[model samples]
Target chain A: MDRKDLKEKLLKIGDLATLPVVAYNVMQLTQNPKASAMDVGKAISQDPALTSKVLKIANSSFYGFPQKISTINNAIVILGFSNIRNIVISAGIIDAYKVEKSSAHFDRTEFWKHSLACGITSKIIASTVGLKNSEEAFIWGILHDIGKIVMDTYIHEEYSQVVQTAKEKGMLIVDAEQTYLGFNHTTVGTLVARKWNMPPALLKVIRYHHNPVLDYNSLRISSIVHLADILCRTLDLGSGGDNEIPIVNEKSWDLMNLDKQTVKTIFAEMEKEYESATAFLH
Target chain B: MNKNKGLHDKSASQDQIDIIEQKYARLKENEPMKILLNAAKEYLTEKGQEKNGS
Candidate 1:
């Protein structure tokens, strides 16, 4: 179908996959300059399941906290508004996109493992490269391939055809999607992120992750996530729906200016953090 | 006849080697991918050694 029709269909699907009310409220509260920790905590506490998940993640090895973090208010205090916001949104997105079925070619668990790996790797890359806000990088990495799931859920038959075409032709899923569906996941992902009112940087990362050089404004974050996706695939962290790795964008790679030694350090840290970060999936 | 059989076997093994090489050729050619893969290999090897030592 055309872009307009595709977006209309995806917008409908976006409505169905709305973020939980508490998660939505927390996102809004954290963005407000006047909102306090108690306000955000109170919003989160409204959803007991989300509250517990947030607390569990705060105490998990992902954060590497030595002392136990027993309450939502404490988590808010220690992690700060942005970090807490990232955690809440991550939990909310995962809950919203709960997969009900798996096909022969795609396993939902493996897809998520890949996404989580990308998130951890992106955080590490962001820190290594001295970009501010590694937490934001983590969420970007997690949500990068969200369009794939959106399509898979909303338009299963066609998406399966796209996956099948990729497998048969040994093409990247994006390319297959372009050739088959007339538009790729990036297009669909941008639409979904817009529907969620995600920030411009995030929307750009979701859209331009494959070709980060396209957007000059958010190039650094986009490039960091791009490299992270490749590294995760290299280490076999998880499957990104297809086996083939996209060629590294030469401009983006040059921008990173990562030396061999720095690359080694990043890989080592990713290996350690990935083992613990899988807790987010559970 | 034995010499011909040995030649055949060598050619068959060479074909298998070629197939394996082709599989990795894409990764080997990409400079950035090469860097990441090498680091991943070293990291995995180091982890394996650590496991064994412990």
Candidate 2:
């Protein structure tokens, strides 16, 4: 399909994958400085399933809380509004794209596992790099590969060909996608993220993660997710569609300033936290 | 005969070494991937040692 037609189709698919009403409300409330914890809590409370998930994640060892966080209001105060917002969006997005059928090449379970591992790895990188709010990194990591699923869900036949071509040619999925389809997942994912009204920084990360040096303004954050994606693939935490690893952009790698010791530390923490973070899938 | 057998074993081991080297050549070619693979190797080794110590 042509670029305009492809984007139009992707936008329609984005509409189909809209977040739950409560998730939208929580996002809006968290962004509003005047909105209080109770207001956000009440918004999330409307969806019992999402509230339970938020509470579970807040209490999970991923956060390493000393005491139990029993209620949505408590979770809001303890985990902070941004964290709660991230949890809601994560849960909502995971729910929205329940893969009824996956091709032989794309294991849905492994796909999400890779995504979740990337999220944990991104959070660790953010903290190690002193990026103020690591939770935002977690959400960016989770949503980075969402465009692949958009294609997998809405355009299964073509997506399967892309996956097969990648495997057969031993090419990176992105390259295979470019060769087979006119555009790749990054473009599709950016459109969907735009449709969801995600932050500009996040949109850039989603779009430019494979080639982060393209965007100078969001280069640092994009590079964080970029490195995190590479590390996750190295550990074989999960599959990001293809088995071959892409060459790291030299500029992106230099921006990380990761030493041997720091890499070891990040890997150890990722190993520990990734186990607890899997609670999102359950 | 023993010398010939020794030469054969030496060639087999060299072939095996060559195969292993080829497996990692792509990964080690990239500077960042080389570092990550090395770190991951050490991390796994240390974890294994800890398990044995425990």
Candidate 3:
């Protein structure tokens, strides 16, 4: 199928088309100007698992707080409605997509490890660059390669071939997907993000992470994820299907003005947090 | 950073055994990412000169 057709088809998949109902409700409430932190907290608290996960993440090393936060209401109050909303969405996404367990060519656990690493690295890079909404960068980095997952889950047989081709040619998986599938995972990922009604910045990260300059409006977040992906691959934090680390789009590298010291510091912090970060997944 | 704190709520039932195992295993096998950063710097310089010459 052509890129547009496949995207349409993938979007039609019942599971991919919508966020879980509670998450969807939270998304709607967030758009309501009158909604309070209490309102949002009550909505999320309906889901026991989500409530605990959100609380756990709020207190994690991901966000360094001075004291313990034992209740959902306290988390919502401190993190704010917008922050809590984003957290709920993140938790919802984890529940929504299940990594394909049987793909002969794919390692689902390693793939998620790579994604989790990128999310951590993206947040750190955003802070290093002094960008607002660093949490959004974390979401973007987590979902950057989501397009690959969509293809793997929905079009497993064809995607297996794409993976094989990528390994054979020593080409990046994104490039290989383009060559074999007439569209890359980035294109499919954008469709998935749109289906979930994600924020514009996130859409750009998923779509333009392979080449961030594609959308100038989302340049900052997109470039941050781009750099994070490179760092993850270089450090072997997690495998993203292929071993070849793509170039750090010189434009994005310069745009961030990254210095070695800053990167080293970020890497060290990432190492420090790595244990806690992946622990959130389980 | 609470070294003793779990990523989730303390009362939550999730185990940290997997996290501990993976952390030690990865640090030993992973490599330095500094080489890529150095290459990015070189590429930026080369691109700047290309623009100037053009």
TM-score of each: 0.87, 0.87, 0.78
lDDT of 3 by residue, A8-123 (tens): 66656535455677887888788788987788888988999888888888888766777988888899888777667767876786666655464778767777788888888898
Q: Give per-residue CA lDDT, model 2, range A1-282, as digits (tens).
A: 665776577667766756568877776787788999999888988988888888888888878899999999888888888888888888877877764466898767778888899988999999998899888999889889998988888877778878988888878899988877778899889877787777787899999999999988879999999998988876667677887666778899899899888999998888788878877877
DockQ computed for model 2 against the true two-chain complex using alpha carbons = 0.27
Off by over 4 Å in 2: A1-8, B1-24
lDDT of 2: 0.79
Candidate 2, position A213, lDDT: 94
Chain A (alone) TM-scores for all candidate structures: 0.94, 0.93, 0.89
lDDT values of the candidates? 0.79, 0.79, 0.72
Q: Which stretch of 10 consecutive residues in model 1 chain A shows the poorest summed lDDT?
A: A98-107
The window of 10 residues in a row where model 2 chain A has the poorest summed lDDT is A1-10
- DockQ, each predicted model: 0.27, 0.27, 0.05
How far is A179's C-alpha from truth in model 2 (Å)? 1.1
**lDDT at residue A114 of model 1 (Cα atoms):** 88
